[model samples]
Target chain A: MPKKKSEESKSNNKGAVRPDGRKVDELRPVKMEVGVIERANGSAYVEFGKTKVVAAVYGPEPMHPRHLADPEKAVLICRYNMLPFSVEDRKKPGPDRRSIEISKVIKDALSTIVALEEFPKCMISVDMVVLQADAGTRVAALTAASLALADAGIPMREMMSAVACGRANGKIVVDLTKEEEDAEDAVDVPVAMSSLTKKIALLQMDGDMTLEEFEEILNKAEEACSKIYDMQREALLNKYEKEGKEVNINDE
Target chain B: MMSSKLTAEYVRSLIERGKRLDGRKLDEFREIKINYGVSEKAEGSAEVMIGNTRVVAGVKMDIGEPYPDMPNKGVLVTSAEFLAMAAPEFEPGLPGENAIELARVVDRGVRESGAIDLEKLCLVEGEKVWVVFLDIFVLNHDGNLIDAAGIAAIAALLNAKLPKITEDYEIVRDELTDPLPIKDIPIPITIRKYGEHLLLDTTALEEDVLTGKFTVTTKINGNICAMQLSDGMSMTKDEVLQAARMARDAATKIREKLFKDKLKELKKA
Candidate 1:
C-alpha cells in the first residue's frame, strides 16, 4: 500500500499537482488510534497516509529512588524509534544517532506545552515508535503522542503538533517525502507548536529561506497546525467515548 | 548477577545438546533487517537489526586540517555508545566492558580493511580535509553487537555522500550528493569457538557458550585485512586456519548479498 502511494506521489510531483490532488494546504489522510498498548499508561497509533507511528505513554508514577524528583514540576521523557521494516529498505533494529538527537529535541520541545507543574515528583514517558516512515514522521509522532497522553488522561496545558516546511526546487514545499526530497532542492524548517495558545513550542530549521519566506511558511504551518490540532482532539475524544467509560482521573 | 562459572557450565551443556537458549541453530543469524536514511538530518544514516540486537549508524562529514603525519589523507573516526535502555546490564554515563569491546571490534574492522580511500577525502592536501565521523548507537541488545555494528557503520558510510558545498562555504545540498571516496568494501565475519568447534553467526546465548571469539575481515577481492583472536584460551594453529577458511566462505556470501541489494542506488547525485 505504501509503495503504491509513493509511486503515485512521485508521478504526481512531476505533474505539478499535489499528491492525492489535494490543495497545497491540504494534508494527506490523517488517522489516529488510541489505547493500543495495554501495558502503557496511555498509548496511541497514528498514521498520516503511509507514515505510521505508535506512541506509548507511561508514568506520572513515582520516580526511581536513584532519580532525584523535582518538588515543583513533572518530567516528560520521550524516545523516538523506527522499526527496521518501516522503510523501503529494512532499517537496523536499534536507535541511531539521529533518533537519539530527535528524542532529546522532542523531550525538550514537548516540555514547553505540557503542564509539568501539575504532577510534581512524577515522571511521564512518551515512546514514539515509527512502524513506517515516509515523510513528516516527526510531526506525525508529536501529534499522535500528545493525543495518546490525553487519551491516557494525562493533564497538559495544551496538545502539540509539529510540522515542517522546506524550500524544495526553489518553491516552499510542505511535508517532503523521500522521492520528492530527491527530486527537489530544499532546506528543512521543522517546528513544534502548541494548539491551545497558538504559540511556538519548538523551532528548528536547516537551509536558508528569506525572512519573508520564513514568516510566510511559518504562518502557513501555524494555520495548518490549528486544523491538525482539532483532528488530534477529536481522535482522543472518540477513543475515550468508544470505551463507554470516563477514564479521567481526578486532577488532584 | 549469577555465577559466571555455573552459567558457563550450563552453556556448555546446551551446546552439547545442540539446542541454543534462544532457539537458534549453531550457524543461523537471528533476524537481519536494514533501513537507510533513518536520520532525516544526517548526511547518511542506517539502522540494522540482528534479532533484537539493534545498531544505528550515521555518517557526518566535516572539514578539518589534515594530520601532520598523514597530510594527504582524510580521517574516519568511529564511536560507539550503548544506551542504558538497550539492555538491563548497561548503565548510563559510564560505558561497561561490553560497550568498550563493541567499539574496539568495530573500529578495527573498518580501519584495518582499508575500505575507505582517505587520501581522496583531502580537500586541500594536508591543510584541509574531510573527517567522516561514524557514530554507532546500540538501542537494544540481544547479542552479536560486533557484526551488527560493523554492518551498520559501513552501510551508513556507503549510503553517505559528500554534501554539496558552494565556493562561499555554504552547503549547496539540493539532492542526494555524490558518493564518498570509497576505494574498497570490506565486511567482517565473526566465528565463535565453542567446545572444539566454530560456528557462524552466534546469537547472545550462543555467545555465552563460547570461551571467546575471533573475527576475520575480508575485502571485496578476497584480501584479508584484519584478524583478531579474542579468547584467552589459546587455539592451536590448525583450529585458527580452519576458522579462517570458514570466515572467507561466510564473507564471500555476505559480499554477494551487499551488491545484489540496491542499497547503494539511493544516491541520486
Candidate 2:
C-alpha cells in the first residue's frame, strides 16, 4: 500500500498561493522510516516533498589513524553527499564545496546534542546521501541524520530537528522549494532546534532580509521543527510499538 | 600545546575577570589595515591585515557561458586557499573542510546581498557573460581569517575595473572602463562565544578555547545577508539575535574605520 502523507494543514498566509499549494507555514509531506538499511548500525530514510535522503550511522567503533583520536572525546564525522543524479543537473560525484560546507554545519548541529563524551577514543560517523533534491536538502539531510543517530543508540541530550523557512511572493513560508529558493525575493534560513527544550542548535541563512523579517520567519521555523520532531518520535516509536516497548525519548 | 582542560579553564577565568590576554575589550577587534592593488597582474586586488593575520584577495574577469537557470546574469566564483605559509597546521595539498567552508560562507554573503549587478555584466543574453573570480589567500593565520578575507574580497571587488571587451566578446585587459557595479557592501563579522563572554576577532589561542562562534554578514542597510554557526555549540534564540546585533555594530565599525583611507584614494585616482 502506498503511504499517503498528510497535507491538510491550514495555510498561515491566507490568500497567498504557494507553488505546490502548501500552506505558508505548512511543511511538504514528510515520510520518515527508521532502520531502513540492513548493514548499517542505524539508518533512516526521510522525504519532504521531492527531497529524499537516507542517513546511516556507523560505529562507536575503534578509531582509524590513531593519531586523530581525541583522548578525551569521540570523533564525530558527518558527510552530507548528493548523488550524481539527485538534482536536475548532474552533479559531479564527490565532496564539492557546497556539500563540504553542509556537512560541516550538520556536524556542528549534531555535535551540540549528541553525548559524544560517553564514547571516548572511538569514531562515530554519520552519513546522509540525497537521492533527490528540490530545495532545503540541508535541513532534510539533517533531520534524517538526527534520526539515524538516535536509532543507532547514540546517547543524546535532546531530540534534534531542522527545517528551512523563507519568503515566496513576499510572504514568509516554511520548507521552501527549489523555485522559491531561486526566486528573486527569497530569503532563506535553515534552522535546527531541540524538539522539546527549543534551544537553537544550528542557524544559517542566505539572502538579504531585514532583522525583523528574519526574526519572524525564524520563529515560525522553530515552531515547525517542534512538530517535525513529534513526527520523528512517532515514527521511531512505531518501530518498537509492535513489541509493546516504550522508548524513553521524553521529547515532550 | 596546553591541555584542552587547562586552556579552557584559563580562558574562562580570564573572561570571568573581564580581561583578555591582549587587554582588549570583549567586543574589541584588533587593528585592521586595508591596502589596494596588491596583485599587479590581477584585474583588481587588495590585501587586508587584522592584527597579525593577513590575506590577499584578487579578482579576475573572464567571458563564460551563463548558467541555464540564470542565463541573463553573470557568475561570481569565490575560492579560498589556506597556504602552508600561513600557519604550521595548514598542509600543502587540496583545501580541506575549513577552506571550503570559508569560501562558501563568503560567497553567500556577497551573492545574497546582491553586491554585484550581475545582470549588467551580460555581453549577450543567454550566450555569454562576465565571470568574476575572487580568490582569497591566507598569508598569515593568527586568527579571524574570515573577517580579514571578507574585507579583502569587497575591497578587491570595489577596486575592480571592468576591462573593455573586444568585438568578439574577448576581454581586453588594456582598456579598462568603469568600476564594477557594486550595489552594496557585505561585511562579515565573526564573534566567538567563550565562557559566557562574547569575544570579537579572537586570536589563535582564543579560538582554541572557544565554546562556539557565529559569523554574521551585513550589507549597507544593516540587514543580514548571510550567517554561519560554528560547531558544537547551542545558543538560545535571544542570544543569537543579540549576536546579530553585535555583528551589525562590529561590521559598521570595521567599515567606517578600515575602508576610510582606501575609499578616499579611489576617489582621488
Candidate 3:
C-alpha cells in the first residue's frame, strides 16, 4: 500500500475497529524457534505476527583488534539488518543511521542480562536479520537475540523480553502493525525487561503522550512481555527436550 | 587475520596435487544461492551467498545534477560496507582498502559493460539526471566477497524500477513506473593463485595462503568488461590468458544457472 493511503486510513479509522480486529491492548501472535543456524554458536528465529527475524550469536571468544577488549568484562556487539524485501519498500542493505542506533540500544539492553564480567577480554556478538518486517522489528530482534545468547550457553542474570506499546487512533494499543505505525500522531513506546526480575532494561519513546498514558502503556507492555517471556522459555525448553535431556531454566 | 603456517603449508601441498582441503577440484566453486527483492525500501535489492560468504546489494535512484564530465548521462555510484558482525576480522568503521576495492571492481564491471542505459535516465540534459546508487554490504566473510558482491549488484540492478516522474520534475516515490533500462548481465569471476595452482572460489582458509588473485568480469557476449589483478605473486602472460578463459566459462555457467530464473520472474512481475 502507498504511504499516503495508509496514513489516510489511520485518520479515517479513529475510534473504529482495528484492521486486525483485536482489542486495544491485545498483542499479535508470537512464535519462536531456537538453534536455527548451524554456523553460529547459537541461533534463533522469531515471528511476531507478520514480522519475522533471525538472530545468531557468536563468541565469548577473543576480541578483535586487541584495543577494544575490556580488562574486566566482555564487550558486546549487536547488529540489526533488515532484508531488502522485509518491508513495503526495498531497504538498502547496510547499517544506516537508524540501524546503527538500534544496534547500540539492543546491545545495551542485552548487556544488562549477560554476565559479561565472567569472560574477561572476550567478546559476544549478536546478529539479527529481519527477514520480513511489519512493525516493532527492533524489539522482536532483541527478543530473539536474547534467546540466542542463552542457547549459546552464555551466562546471564535472566532472559529479556521486549514489546512495544503505542497510541493509535486515540486508543492505546499493545502492538502496532506497519499500518498503525505509519499513522500520524501515533506515539510508540518500546520497552524491554528481565523476565525474572521484571526490571526494565530498555525504554525508548517517539511521538507524545501524557504521563498517565505512558504509564498505562508501560503496564500493558509489561503484561504482554510476561506472556512473551513464557514463549521464549518454552522455545528453549523445546530445543533441549528434542535432545532428550531434561532441562530447567532455574537450574541453569 | 593470518592463517597458521601449518595450515597454509597443508593447503599448498593439497593444491600441488590438484586437490583442495574441501575435497573439490582446483577450479570448482562453492555452492551459490541468490534471492532477489530482499529489501522493500530500496528500488531493488538482492542477497547472494557463495558457500558461507554472503553479500547483499541495494539500488536507490534519485534525481540529481549530472557530473561535469558526463552532463548528458546519468551517474552510478557504488559503495561497499563490511559489517563487523559478518566476521571477527572485520572491524566496525569506515570502508577500508578491501571494501573500496570490492566496490570499485563491481562498479567497473557494471559501468563498462553498458548494462544500464544511462541516457534514458536523464531528466534534463546537463541540468538534472537520475543518479543510481548501488550499495553493497558484506553480511558474512567466509571468503571470495568480490564475486558474491558482484553477483548481488547485478541481480539488484536487474530487479530495479524507476519511480514515477511528474512533468514538474517531481519524483513520486510510492508509484513505480517501469523497470530500469538494463542491457546486459556482467558477472565477475575471481581466481586465487596458491603455490603454483590457480584455485577458483577460494574459501577463507585458502584465501590466507593465496599469493595472487585475478578477477575478470565478463558480459553476456563473452566480452571482458573489467579485469583486476591484485599483485602478490607474479603470473605469466599465458597464465593470465588461461585464467581469463576460465573466468569467461564460469561467468557463462553462472548466468544460466543463477540469473536466468530470476530474470524471468522479474519480467513477469
Candidate 4:
C-alpha cells in the first residue's frame, strides 16, 4: 500500500520475479477444454491466468433474412461480453459503450484471420464471454476464441493471437495485469495478429507513448504473440489428437 | 383458490399424477451442459444449456476511469439479449421485458452480494479502473434461464485470469499473470411455487402454470445477498423462510458442482 512498496509490487510479480527482478514475458498459465457445451456447433473454455473466456462458434449457414447478404463473402459477426458477476465487482447488465466498442474491435480483428470467401453467403456467430478478467483480456480472448473456432472445425486462414504492450514508468511491459495497470504511469496498446500471416489485424492504444516506445512495444507484442501462437497451436493439436483417436475408433 | 381455467387445471392434473405439464418432476432440474471459450474474441466466455433453455455469457474488460461516487470500486456491467433464435416468443432486436428482467435479476444478485473487491479495481482514486462487462445471449429458450445464466456467468468468471501490471497505470504484457480481484462469490437458486408446492427448477410449461417465481442468491459464506420475486407475486412468511432454506441448500449443491476440485486443474491446464 505504500508508494515505494507499490512500485516494488509493480516491478515484482506474484511470488516469482524475472531475472531482472521483473516477471518475464510468460503467460500466466494457459488452460483449455473442448466440448464443454453440448448443443453448440463448437465450444471451448480458455483461461489465461485469471483472465477466463468462453468462446462459442455457431453456424456456417444462411444469413438472417433482414440482413443483407454478402454475395461474395461470408459474414463473421463477433460479440464480446462479460457477465455482471464475471468480475470481482458486480456490473450493470446491458450493452454499454465499452461492450459495443470491444465487440466491433473483435469483429474487425477476426475478419483478418478467417477465410470468409469460402463460406460465401453464410454467417458465423462468434460469441465471446468474459467470465473473469485480469488484463490482456482482449488478447487472451482473441487467442482463445480462435482456438474454439478451430475446435469447431471452422475454416480459418490462421489462428489469431494477441497480447498487450505498454510503457510503464518509462519501461515497456508485456501482458499487463490489473495491478500494474493501476500503478504504472504509462500507455497501453493491445494488438492482434494472425499466426500464419504474421500480420497485425487489430491495433488499439491508450495513454501516451513516444514513437520509439511504440516500436519497442510492437516488438514486445510480436514476441509475446508468438508465444501465444505456440499455446494456441498446442491447444488445437491436443484437441485434434484426442478427437482423431475417437474418429479412428468410430471408423472401425 | 383454484382458478377455473382449463390450463391451470390441466397443469394441476399433471402434477397430481406425478407428471409435469412438460413431464418433469417437482424437484427435477433440467439437464445442463456448458461449453467454454465459444467466442474467438472474448476474454472469457461460456455457453450454458439447460434443457431447451440456452444462454451464453461472455466477459470483456477494458481500462476506464472509476466513478466519483465509488472511486475505490470498479465498473461491472451485465446485459442480456433475448434473441429471436431462442424461440418464437422472443423478438428480434430491442430486448423485451423478459430480457430486461433477467438482466436486472442477475445483476442484482451479483452486485448486492458484494462478490468482488471493488476497491482493488481502483488505480488512481477515481482516475482509472478496469471496467468489466458481461453480456448474456439467450440462444434458445425452453425454460429456466435464471439457472442457466447464473451458471454460465460464474463459469466464465472463474475461468478468467487477471493481467499483469506495471507502476504508473500501465499493463505489463509479459511480466505477470494473476487471478482477477475476486472477493465474493454469489450463486442464485430459482424456485417456482406451484399449487401448494415449491419446485427447485421449472420448465416452460411449469413456469406457465406456476403462480409465482422467486430467486434467492447466496454468497459462499452462507449469507443471503439478494432476492428477486417475479410476476408481482408475494409469499407468506412461512413460504419465504422455506424458500430461503431451500435456496441455501441449492446454492451449496451448485457451488460444489461448479467449483469442484477441477477448477484448480482447469487453471493449471
TM-scores (chain A) of the candidates: 0.85, 0.92, 0.89, 0.87
Q: What is the DockQ for all candidates, taken in turn? A: 0.01, 0.77, 0.01, 0.01
Cα displacement (Å) at residue B111, model 1: 24
Best by TM-score: 2
lDDT of 4 at B101: 60
Which of candidates 1 and 2 reaches a greater TM-score? 2
Q: Write the per-residue lDDT of candidate 3 for residues A1-252, one digit (tens) a residue.
A: 101111123334444467776667667767789999999999998888888899999998999868989999899889999998887778988877567657766776787679999999999999999999989998999899999999999999889888888888878898798888767667676777778867665555555454456557767888888888988898898888866544454456
Put down candidate 2 lDDT per residue, A70-159, tens digits, no spaces.
887899999999999998879999998888889998998998888889988899999999999989898999999999988899998988
- Model 3: residue B104 alpha-carbon error in angstroms: 0.7
| Candidate 2 regions with alpha-carbon error over 4 angstroms | A1-16, A244-252, B1-7, B260-269
Sort by lDDT, best first: 2, 3, 4, 1
Candidate closest to the true structure, highest DockQ: 2
Each prediction's RMSD over C-alphas, in Å, is 21.9, 3.8, 21.0, 23.7
lDDT of each residue in B1-269, candidate 4, tens digit only:
22346887787777776677667777676666778888746667889887788889988766788887688788888888888988776678776556766676677667656655667777777688877788888888777887788778876765555556667667654443655565555777787775457787777666766645667677665666555554423344345557767877877777766676543454354
Candidate 3 structure quality by residue, lDDT tens digits, B195-227: 457878988888887754677788776766665
lDDT for model 3, please.
Answer: 0.82
Model 4 over residues A37-111: C-alpha lDDT tens digits? Answer: 567788777776678888888888887763656888888777788889877778788665566656666776677
Stretches of candidate 4 above 4 Å error?
A1-252, B1-9, B21-24, B163-176, B262-269
In model 4, how large is the Cα lDDT of residue B169? 64
Docking class of 2: medium
Candidate 3 ranges with C-alpha deviation above 4 Å: A1-252, B261-269
Report how far residue A208 has shifted in candidate 4, in Å.
42
Residue A247 in candidate 2, Cα distance off native in Å: 15
- Candidate 2 lDDT over B1-269, as tens digits, reads 33388777887788888778888888989898889998767889999999999999999999998988799999999999999999887898888888988888889999988888999888889999999999999999888988888999999999999998879887788778898987777899998885466778988778877766789999867999999887667787887888899999999777777666644554464
